[model samples]
Target: MKKEKIQLKGITWGHTRGFVPMVATAQRYEELHPEIEIVWKKRTLQEFADKSVTDLAMEYDLMVIDHPWTGHAAAQKMVIPFDDFLPETFLEDQRENSVGESYASYNFEGKQWALPIDAATPVAASRPDILQELDVLLPRTFDDLLALAQKGRVGFSLLPIDVLMSFYMFCCSSGEVPCQNDEQVVREETGVRVLKLFKSLADHIDERFYAKNPFKVFEDMTQHDEIAYCPFAYGYSNYSRQGYARKLLHFHDLVALKAGDEPMTSTLGGAGLAVSSQSKHIDVAVDYARFVASPEIQETLYVENGGQPGHLRAWKNTQVNALTANYFVNTLPALERAYLRPRYDGHLHFQDHAGDVVVHYLKNGGDERAVLAELNTMYRESLAWEGVHG
Candidate 1:
């Protein structure tokens, strides 16, 4: 029997080191299953957001979606559940830490909506030479980090989401969970506290010294050794392999706010693959999703193509662990502890409001209380609007 032609459109937000492995894996899949043609819909993260899954689902068979958007995508019924199609053995084969409970980030309404592709968290990456010169230990607490920041010797670089993850770390350290009751409700006090801590850090951040893009920051740290410490996504290991930094610095788990508070928690960062409900080729799409999730593909992709595999087993592979010197392998357990951002249908609006709060306080030294109040109001209004719309 002739193989039926299967075409899949996969979307990725950016062409970054973090995504190289998955993209390579897709290419390999095409080679193995020649009948199935996979076309990548490449876009910057911002462009991906602007295009929206609702629009893309109409055009694509598969989508690589951000984890925070899982809830919103399911709420909109833009993607279909692959739970029934995904084999139990494939799911069972994943590393315990990588797939089982950690997979909860991809679950919505008691159903598995997507498969983890790349899992990460913000960690402190510093130049070993710089730290040696400063005679400072890897920062253990926010206060220790702040002291270093005050010395004018430490240069900090952060992504917009890094600011939020920093906030999550603070809130979790303060014994707070951003979401309550699994109903997509953010605790106002937790949000406020997180925001306030972020603002405090912003006061010390030397804006002029920081790099605007993450890759640039990695380059600065590795090439020029310009930055001493940065809150970088764990995926930096891929960049490190490119000979940007010569093992001069390493990643330290995110710092906690206080000694007795909850352990330091960073935000869960990365994307997942989901099939569009509108696709006619559901079986082929499901097979491709599982293939990408497989341990062999995950391990090979990460080791050869620089993709960060979301499977725990892939993370534990001797070859893969050796590839990047167990950077991500050492960090996966920590990444599992990371929190996710607010996932509402109005997530974009909430992110904008929260980002504004961060900018106001960080850039202009705005009052934390007032900013918190404004954020709380925005959260409430957005949730209400979502409820009415639903």
Candidate 2:
């Protein structure tokens, strides 16, 4: 005789890559453990980026979360700290093998809030067949990228969040990092240069990119014959895999900021699995999360089911690369050097509004001096939330 199975629910982003792998893994986990069953629900990718984890934790036993939320979640005690449930030995292993700062990103206020299941950053994506048809060589330097943009084939996600991230990228490449301290976001000169560069590139590419997210950009590229390359958008491994789209797109690092060196760095973006502190099924949820993130499961079942893994072993696995057209290996360097966003409890408030300031400037003409002043004001106001109550 057997007892009735336990049921658990989860929330994750809703995309073929975002939603499918978790469902597939849950099916297998249930098959192996007849005592438990897990169901996953989804919100849009933009919502995934924008939602409040404190609110989501109340509704779902498990959550797929962005790393930036750890600060607020930790402060509010809205989610279970992985360090409390997962063993130190296991944690040390995760820390040692993290793809870029994937493992560390989840650690805030000296506690681990989630298990990194996917690791990605902006990298170059191109349709070689289309580029070859147009007789344009892929770009290698910032100057080359601008030259190619002038040819009217390059496109990248120009959504506000992405524009903000691109601003950070150009700011970093210009020798000043954004939000280095609580009081400021970027140097004035660097902000001006980054905005000017973005406007210059936007001048050449189709205006439709302003509305496209990374997934949409990939979809449009596969559906049409016009765009040939994207210098930076969050990498989606599915495009590199066969039969996942209308056409396979090759993934590689970004064009260099200068001649003969590492490719330009971009903002880090990935998803992790976290257990809601409110869940009655903590043990079961933790077990499933551990199972989903283990290297063996990550390299084989997760990748096979369309997940981009956060484990370094998966990135280095030859078979994984063979299946995904070397997307992991070629883009690994960029991820390893990717820039991390600020984790202050009030950072999200800034992110939600600050991006639009840049986007507005990009689309409609605005004074660069005004934009810089606005960002600095937002930065100072956000830091005040550190001590003030809601």
Q: Model 2 clash pairs?
A: none
Residue 137, candidate 2: alpha-carbon lDDT: 84
* Model 1 TM-score, all chains together: 0.87
lDDT of 2 by residue, 1-390 (tens): 878789999999998778888999999999999889899999998999888999999999999999988888888898998889988988888899999999888999789999999998889999999888888788899888888788888999989888888888888777787898766798777888888987888777788998999999999888888888999999998998889888889998888878976678788889999999999899999999999999899999998999999899999999999999999999999999898988778888788788899888878868998998999898888888766833
Question: Model 1, residue 324: what's the lDDT?
Answer: 67
Candidate 2's TM-score reads 0.97
Can you write out model 1's per-residue Cα lDDT over 219-279, one digit (the tens) per residue? 6667675567775444466654535355445666666677654447666776678899999
